[model samples]
Target: MRKFISRAAALLLAGVMTAAVAGCGKNSDSEAKDTAKKWTELDQTQITEAMGLGWNLGNQLEASSGGLPSETCWGNPEITKELIDTIKAQGFKTVRIPVSYLDMIGDGPDYKIDTDWLDRVQEVVDYVVNNDMFAIVNMHGDGYYTVDHSWLLCAEDDDKQTEIKDKYGKVWTQIADRFKDYDQHLIFESMNEEFNNDYGKPDEKAYDNINAYNQIFVDSVRATGSNNEKRWLLLPGWNTNIEYTAGDDYNFKIPTDKGCKADGKRIMISVHYYDPFNFTIDENKTAKTQWGKYAVKNYDNWGQEDYVDSQMALLNEKFVSQGYPVVIGEFGAQDKTEKFADYNEFRRYWSEYLIKAAKKNGVVCVYWDNGYNGNKGFGIINRFDYTITQPDLIAGMMRAINSTDDYEIPSPAGYTEVRKSAKAS
Candidate 1:
């Protein structure tokens, strides 16, 4: 859910939109009847298994400098039916669409969402649903939910909590209403990774607020109509971190929806994985650039297969086994430094191992692709032409889910040859 935009550009956009009203203009008067057929009611586990291999339409709708800019502002092509069709062709069964409603929403009590933005979002969603793929639409990066401006941060202040709850409720109410007609193919994610406190550590009160917000989301959506009553909803853990979320200390609780007549059968927990940050995200060369059995130098000491197994095990034991499912909504290792001889090979291994481990534990895995194809970005596909730019990585993912065999640890040819030559010298 993260993207880069220069400070100057953000300031300029804010200044331009300052004179305009905050809402997305006005809600449309045309109340389209629910023509879409409702999907068969399935529990969380069935939904997760059916979701198969998933990919994120990242850095597009979620890309906003300040105001709601075009999806192309981040240099990604406008999302089209073909793009989703290509994804389906590539063996993906689910698409996670990340969106930001910060600029698209008005101020205060109503916090009205712009109808134009809603229409735009729905149009993109239709492309996914029409193709017979599961689609997830989430509240991506928004300033109001951050640590500095977060309403969830003020745990001691009751009045502040009420105000935050009110605004949060309004936002979801509008969103739920807009997508109410869509069947189970379209899922609503409560929010992206937004949990943070002033102290930068887990706060009990902040966690409480998060639970409240999730409850509000569930309640609001279900009240819209029966279409949403059984809709599969994804709720994220604090910061969407696996350890923090599944940890014994976090006191994470799934919100109960009195309106949901099925008794919380459709709710699923979401947690992200970018474990061994040194290898997955760190830009420094001092960190591990190589991993797996063939890793020549600076191999990651942590985040090996066992690490993945342990985390997945925790989720399965805590949630999945109990009937609630889990989704690894965002997980990827960046190809920031391609100069390494076995970079692509290492990426393939990483992708295969993660997917294999996730599925083994009955968790749905979704890879995060932000559409930046060079250094410091996780771009696998050339979104402009709808082509697979990283075939090895894509192939590895396909092999992992399709193959019945467990993922074998890879030994890169370059790494082995380099070691052999050095020993001979």
Candidate 2:
């Protein structure tokens, strides 16, 4: 029988599973764990600073069709160590690998993840970690309503809570154990962009369920012991929206980590930035192509430089200032070169300024690359040949990452004071 199955039976018979045995797995590689933890005796700030700029291995491992996941399902080639090697060479110290189990997970109490799929994911993570880069593994598309067999639903009926929570615990239990021996370089993020589908005021019950999911994620991973006990975890708020996460209207709770010897010093808050969707993802509406304060035409009056400043500042005040580091897990604008003549220039400018803003506020930013190049895509490098498709854009971003001087945004063409009301606070 699987370890989780026996543990579940025991929990039912004993009425509860104690915290002491949550990480009741084997630690065959204790020596490695000790060495990895000892390699860096730094707090969250120093650790995050060491991470530098991050990039997402997006639309590949997270790709699914009819609920079945395949790395090539989304038209991207199989993930190669060479691809990660090139990424590391490009000055990215961290790689965020978004994943989804969906049909890859089994039914019932244990909810065993498919060994083949899990192993493949591990192989990719090793490619990054072995390259001396931080690897962030996360539960990616399991919560999306569009994905088939996605049971990690926060908006489901209350009667389904037991099954949902059980599966959640079992999934993370298996994942944590699989990578329990890994060092601090392997970070496990709770979930990606999860929340009630409602874009308006979030549902209270759904938000509460998200909190429960995060708590369960932390508890399950820590229970697995080994390096997981001290591993840095990335937790996302509702939809990973800056306003919803940090604003006073919605309550986003950080999970309690009694398992960590250093209180919650190992935890990091995650949020995404794609403000002014009109210019970021909405490629069909090409009128809002230009961005930043210096755009002469086709620009959004809101979500400009000031908007980015306000959002990053909110995260710094709420979390970063209080010990928890913030990660902008995914942020990038789609290619609009076909629509606008100098779209690439504006896009490069957007990335440069955003990196500077994140650096200014002491937040880590990861570019979202969906692995597709050309118009209407968020890709920066071609996954097939492992070449940098956006040379100027990537170069400017790297400069911003390493530069010591503050990158100041020039004032708008006709503006004096800032537009506070339109900003996303």
Candidate 3:
């Protein structure tokens, strides 16, 4: 009985000690988490910087383990014959795959992303580099993930932010190891659209976050122990908007790490153009409203050559002049146009303007054409028949890429209603 009593007393003492330590470590209501914890992926720095010919294939968002090929949505994969033929067939030598990695990884700080998901994503990237194309992959629409993590940057407690940094490290480690052996053509963008304005911190704080995030990304991918050491890296300015990075009001300081400076501008500053802005990006994404973006039958003096050129001039100054190649990573029309003729006409015009502007200013242009689930142009190829829309454009792109000289660029008005009507079905 006496021995039992002594054991009970020891157990009570141990409980008391545990509670004290936990209490001492407790964060104050106003204290934020810290970034003090270190991980290997947060330390390495293997990178490639260069002027790259690239395009972003939109609506290709996916979970880690790739899916069975959506007609226009994420998954499916970018390696099918149709995709390869279309991409390689075009003059494009590089492809940017923007992916959302949330569902694939749990919300936990040390979540282990599913390996199968990682493998599938890698396979598509392999196909791109293998074909002699520079492949740019990035964290797509991940703003949602960070938004939920506001505590990391906005919480009253510093300790929470540190924990958030820990989460970032864990996520990148999984990404880096997956594509470690890929070629230099395979570049990893740190993140897509670092938009967190609610933190109430100065814009500089956001910039600092970008630097820290890129460091983790570079360090994580380099740990894969292969050619990733020299693989190209892309740094986005704010939200990948041309106006944001290239406008007079926008001035983003580029980031460098571990004695590395920004690569004589090899880092491509990505931008998305859907000019006459409202027509292009309405949050109300319905087929009818989507078509509205292309319904402009009248362009007053503002849509004239001078005005368009003026806008593009800003882009050139901000990016091209900086010696860094820029890419219109995405641009496309939603199906808001009431008439198919309007759709085709607007498409043709938009395509012509965007393409020439890109070429003229020495930027690469890629359309965001994902018309999945009955939407238009999600996938260039008709999944059932395996045929492609805009065959002429793809064909022309190839010719341009291979030709010794520049081709005569066409205007949007020239395509006419016949082609639109013919291809309408």
Candidate 4:
């Protein structure tokens, strides 16, 4: 277990503010900015290969939840050495740490990310780099759920936007300055799930609003100094989902303010593949879909090369072919009641369709899973804590990504630390 850390909330200008929950500044000793500068040295090809078969370390962040987490929850005891080794052994080169900077914010719910929370977040990231794994740490559900990237949503007035931009500057300025020590392997995704919060509300703007906001996000992430100059950034389209991003009119032009560039080749475009969200998120009892039914276990759905081909056809035409690399940032259907399907089928197809396609094309895939719920065959295994699971799906995808399997990870090697240590020893 890693040493526990604390966090505080930084104050801000309400909806438009770039606020950090107030408290002492976080520990920046290890992740120096000078080191962060090295990221620019990495070109697009290196970024793409390193990102192939990336893994999403979910549930630790609460960006949409409005705050940050107590430092401890940011990994430490939760992430065992075995887990790290398993991911590495499976051929995954990157781990995307989804973080909510609000969970540990403020004294209560006044909205502040505790400073300790930041420290802990950094610690888990360190664990990834320490283990020889590339790490992609970024704002997560927190920025979407409670707050929903308020500034991007344009919740506040014009003046508020400027104020919030400054706040955004302060928030990332601190983060970049702190984690700057890590190598290019330690990447930073600008925002998570940049969707429209007011879909049908009184003040709903057209989807075009999301495009505008994305531009703002990119510009903001860049202004934080050279640390982010050429750092590989994952720029999610306005909604971060495929349908909208691939739409004809909603072109998310790469940002081009003074410092930004065109082609966005260095930046990977993120498009989540939960197309059948009802299937992935809803358990038959609620928003259920075919996901809980036969789609998961059978591998039949996954094996359907046609479905895979079609989806990628559309994706490549709409986005990938445009020159930017893509990533299935999130994908998984829930295994639940009413919607309950055989776990076997669920895993087979879901994995096949998502990971297989990601490999065939130039895209990277991230299975959306947390160390919760045992039935979620999607858990890589049936374990809730995510501590024990199979890496079959991960390995298969890795095989697809690399094309030629010069290095194949054996099954027995993925089980546990004891087994891994035994093998290595």
**Cα RMSD for candidate 4?**
10.7
C-alpha RMSD by candidate, in order: 5.8, 10.1, 16.8, 10.7
Candidate 3: segments with Cα more than 4 A from true spot: 1-55, 61-82, 106-109, 145-160, 197-208, 222-225, 248-251, 259-266, 278-296, 300-308, 335-340, 371-378, 392-408, 413-425
lDDT of 2 by residue, 266-315 (tens): 88999888777777766555458777656666778788877888888898
lDDT of 3: 0.49
Residue pair clashes in candidate 2: 22-223, 23-223, 23-224
Give the number of the best model, judged by TM-score.
Answer: 2
**What's the C-alpha lDDT at position 218 in model 1?**
95
For model 1, state the Cα shift of residue 377 in Å.
1.7
Q: Runs in model 4 with CA error above 4 Å?
A: 1-42, 63-68, 71-77, 80-82, 103-114, 145-162, 198-209, 257-264, 285-307, 336-341, 381-387, 395-399, 402-425
User: For each candidate, what TM-score against the reference?
Assistant: 0.86, 0.88, 0.67, 0.70
lDDT, candidate 2, equals 0.78
Give the Cα error of residue 47 in candidate 3, in Å: 14
Question: What's model 3's lDDT at 324?
Answer: 58
Per-residue lDDT value at 172 in model 2:
96
Query: What would the per-residue lDDT of candidate 1 be over residues 277-314, giving only the tens digit for each residue?
Result: 76776665655777655566777766766688799899
Candidate 2 vs candidate 3: the TM-score winner is 2
Who is ahead in lDDT, 2 or 4?
Answer: 2
